[model samples]
Target: MNRSRKIVLFIAISIDGYIARPDGDISWLDDVQGEGDNGYSEFIQSVDTVVMGKKTYDDVLKLTNNQYPYEGKTSYIFTRKETSTNLNLVFTNENPAAFAEKLKSEEGSDIWLVGGADLLDSFMKEKLVDEYIITTAPIILGDGIPLFKANNPEIKLNQKSTRQYGEFVQYHYVHA
Candidate 1:
């Protein structure tokens, strides 16, 4: 199948390249100042689906009043542990790369690879990611969850755009 849909990794990381604290605390992000949603509203509007690691899903659930954050988007949680299904959330044990390839073949606006390190590793290993939209916050976590965890082959990226929102800098890159 032709994989026309772009798989975009949209995430926030510390200046030192950590997504969260070792204990999964992202409270540091609360201090970032911006006009509004810091471009997230526009980015989410272009996304029709979201793929995230189980840990990320769990963390989000804990942070958001026990509700799913991505309301209208079809959400897939990559996990080996069994989980009950919800209306918009699907828990799957399938290989991340294969599942992502299949998803990309379907007609959709774009797939948001909202993450945890391991899922990013899997996709990187299979070369499934097409673009990356990373926002770097000013604070640096000395040691924490690295943005790309798994040891995978190096991939090249071409910088497309960049924007600054207060103390944060957002970078857009396309696979090259």
Candidate 2:
């Protein structure tokens, strides 16, 4: 039995399997943000914390009127460079799995691995990801930041469940 606090990954991808445009443009996602007829809103509220890459943070900041959804939840940001602004925010320059283990040791809630591809790739490479919940939108970007970058390692997933919401399809995949 695994006693570790699970790290959950929640993302919205296109039907063609892309997270954002090649330039990190996620204008399409905004249209269907939290529009899932399913329990996605509940899913987001259930999490205790969220971890994201530096670029993802920047992108999200631009999209969300500078208000981070995980403001109440413990938020962790992974970045090699230092930011003088995120003083109160948990920031780390360490490996994903190692940092995750540390977070698991401390008293807290569930962890969310939010991404911009690079960070997701690192976690996938370390095999630290426990559960994946993806919302697949209807339209294709045709070009933009992919859900997984080219540098990511190959992985296999076991489908947990699927739900249709508006023009989006949600896919829940767990470790195979």
Candidate 3:
């Protein structure tokens, strides 16, 4: 039987494990020692679909000129509030775990779990994530939104690789 598509969590966090500030500010990520791609270009190329929380989607919109960045890939925003859909973007109120299971069963390139803490918690709770690619910037936010908010029971992961670029360290892990 063909296996389900991999669900990968690709995100950056501060050294203290915060993905953003209290008000959802990620300005701290702007300081990187080296220039050029930082492997993101290659990483994104492997993703055919993206699943994100409403807050994350809104945050991304703020970065663009009010334009959707993942124009060519399938994008789904998990939201409870009414939201309008545009090309390549769909807002769904479906159960996250159910939706994720259906998506993974489909034939496609890996799915990218672009996140907010809530969405991450839901997916992790369902044990839907297949791999995690986290890049840590060498700065700590004394207090902020953590990478994982829920009191998740331990999940085992096998380290696949580790790479360092200037002050950033990227860890690649697969569910074990």
Candidate 4:
């Protein structure tokens, strides 16, 4: 078996494949009737690092009342702006696939792609995502940021497992 660190896309998306509303609002995912943490606590334990777009990083801070939730993990925030990089956050505009390839070769556990639409688009273009653990929320905003953009690179994945968390259905898929 190929034994190297993996980049996993672990996220909760809407039933219509929207990750957020057009305004980057994810408040709809705030309260879903789900089992204890909905496997989040367990999943977070498996990664030592996180990769996300600047907007995503900012969103986390807002949602957590300015407290960075990924405290102990190194966070790579992709950005073009010259934002203040402090503590465990590493802001960079490195090419996504190159950065991901380099990170995966290093000795570490899996990495979490805590996303916004753009970052996912970058990774998807190069097929850098190794696994997708998507939990689908029931509500749809009708018009929003879709999970995949039009003309995105096509990929094939094999369903590894399916899980139920109250009204949410989580699907685990590995690149095929």
Using lDDT as the measure, the top candidate is 4
Note the Cα lDDT for every prediction shown: 0.89, 0.78, 0.88, 0.90
C-alpha positional error of residue 156 in candidate 4 after TM-score superposition, expressed in Å: 1.0
- Greater lDDT among 1 and 4 belongs to 4
Q: Give one digit per residue, the lDDT tens place, for model 4 in 75-127.
A: 89999976556888899998887898899988888999999788998889888
Of 2 and 4, which scores higher on TM-score?
4
Better of 2 and 3 by TM-score: 3
TM-score of each: 0.94, 0.86, 0.94, 0.94
- Cα lDDT tens digits for candidate 2, 20-108: 87777778866764543456667877677788998888888888899875667777888898734363477678877788778787765
lDDT of 3 by residue, 1-176 (tens): 68678999999999889999999999888876744666788889999999999999989999887888888999999998976677788899888788987898798899999998899998888788899999999898999999987678699999999988777888999978
Error of 4 at 135 (Å): 0.5
Candidate 1 global lDDT? 0.89
**Ranking under lDDT, best-scoring first?**
4, 1, 3, 2
Please list the Cα RMSD from the true structure of every candidate, rounded to 1 decimal place.
Answer: 1.9, 2.7, 1.5, 1.7
Global lDDT of model 2: 0.78
